[model samples]
Target: MAAAPRGASAADFETAATHAIILDHRSGRVLFRKNPDEPIPTASMSKIMTVYMLLEQLKAGTLTEDDTFVVSEKAWKKGGSKMFVEVGKQVRVGDLLRGIIVQSGNDASIVVAEGLAGSEEAFAERMNEKAQELGLDNTTLRNATGWPDPEHRMSVRDLARLASLTISNFPDYYGLYAEKKFTYHDIEQSNRNPVLYSFDGADGLKTGHTEEAGYGLVAAAERDGQRLIFVLAGMESARERATESVRFMQWAFRTFRNFKLFADGEEVETAEVWLGEKVRVPLVTAEPLALTLSPDMREQMRVEVVYDGPIPAPVKAGEPLAELVVTIPGVETVRQPLLAGSDVARLGPMGRIAAAVGHMIWSAE
Candidate 1:
């Protein structure tokens, strides 16, 4: 998916951020992108991953909200944002999550890291391993928090991917990002995510800032039945981060609409079979198919099923046999595989001979 105006062939949307990407959550389509793959300093936005590690444990039943982790001297002494956790005091898993999400507490991040892996270094190792497993090719974790480290980098696209995973895979824990404030030891700090406060449907994600990374945000929102996730980095200030993020989300939701072309296993075309028990086999989509398109492009969309004619016999159900190509004016062409919808048994020896003769005769005619 791509963004374009009503009659333009190229994207017209622009942003002030150094790197960015907007994604349609349901269809997994990229609506807009600019330098999305470049690895750069992530700042505290990396706490989303730190919190994600904890969420995994909670969802898997390995850790409960009541479970406590003793805060270390290092956690208490760490600078930047603070949850005001006391040194040597055991903190609940739930409060630490709020600290990390709502307060952007570096101390809380470290507490979770140390409690889960015995040390920040070990926890970062697990983060790296999990990044690989999640197919985030441009991310590297050097510490538990998104502190200013030279090697602690993540691409805007990777951050969007991580945001998507966090929302879809851990819905129960993802709500923490929407929390407005969290108080610990009489100290209260508001969540750093700007969209949560400004946007209509906005909820989760995280924010980041450093002299090197500037300001960044991973914002998500849902309106009506659609959801979008976007990432931004290298803005000059918090105000710009907030303005651009909300504007981008509004632009994305306002412009593009996701259109469902076919449901899973829905037949799109029928292809002739060669010497099979059946004369033809239905071609169907293996997964639900949807695309994000501007309203203008939607009217001009064209679909085609391309395949070799008279496919060989003994076709098994779900075998890839064709391609469904969708073309929309002013947007990139999309192609997806089409599968055989049902089994088509090969004809017996005599039946094959007779069918071949019939095919030959039909060809002559």
Candidate 2:
């Protein structure tokens, strides 16, 4: 198995946000990150998980778009963003989903929670379970609405990971995130995700803000054939979050490009064989080496074949013998195993004796 780059340094970039990350969706590569693992209040970004849980049930055939849930008094009176759902009025699952996603309605989240799990508190427990199932270690969900609870927190990386999973796992329902405007009960509001309105190829995901969590966004975009997922949090204001998010996405797509570094079965180097019929064996990678890099750094990329010199005889074809170490100036070093390209038989007794004599002469010099 080959190791991937850790992440490139981002000292050259500027942003008002305190926590942020950018990832290559196809390759799962971390292009840039700042305090990505630090746990912080996610605000309504936690709603992504809530929406994801509902989507899972939808995919499982346990829930339907047409199914309706009555709005309880709790949902009707809940503050923050509103979908204006009337108490005791039954609302379809589909409309509530749109309400939560587009309108950021606290009421819609509570209704879905109670309808699905009998209560918001019980539904929050389900969110925590789903977080564990998704391998999100840094996330803790205390409510479905992301209601500014002290215990409701998630890392920026987890938010990006959730966004990636939502896009990949539930393609059908993912379109809800892209809806520009959704009206329920004659109340209208545009999607809060700034990227969707500002940039081309920007699709789904969510945004978050509160007195404790500041302003944040979990966004994804696709251009050409590549996709990128990004997360930002702890911004001073919504304007700062929107401005920095667009600039960062533009730089990610414009400044970096994917390049093929090595072709499969292409010999990268040769390793010496000791006391064998063949003096050397070709070293090659089994898979193509492709990487995303900035134009200026491509020239700085280096590949080195490292191994114990003069590999022993009786080496088998396709045996692991060495490693190809790849390094770039601002990126972490990646290593790929290099395999022996062919078998090599040991030298006969007379040939070995002659080789020993040559080795002694070389050592004496």
Question: Best by TM-score, which number?
Answer: 1
For candidate 2, write residues 140-230 as lDDT tens digits.
9899988888888899889988888898899999989999999887777999999998999999789999999999999999997678888
TM-score of each: 0.89, 0.81
lDDT of each: 0.88, 0.87
Off by over 4 Å in 2: 1-5, 8-10, 264-267, 270-284, 307-322, 339-365
Please, what are the lDDT tens digits per residue for candidate 1 over residues 290-322? 767777778998999999888999999999999
> What is the Cα-based TM-score of model 2?
0.81
Q: Per model, state how many residue pairs clash.
A: 0, 0
lDDT accuracy of residue 356 in candidate 1 = 83
Quick one: RMSD of model 1? Answer: 3.3
Which runs of model 1 end up more than 4 angstroms from their true locations? Answer: 1-11, 276-278, 296-300, 314-319, 327-333, 342-354
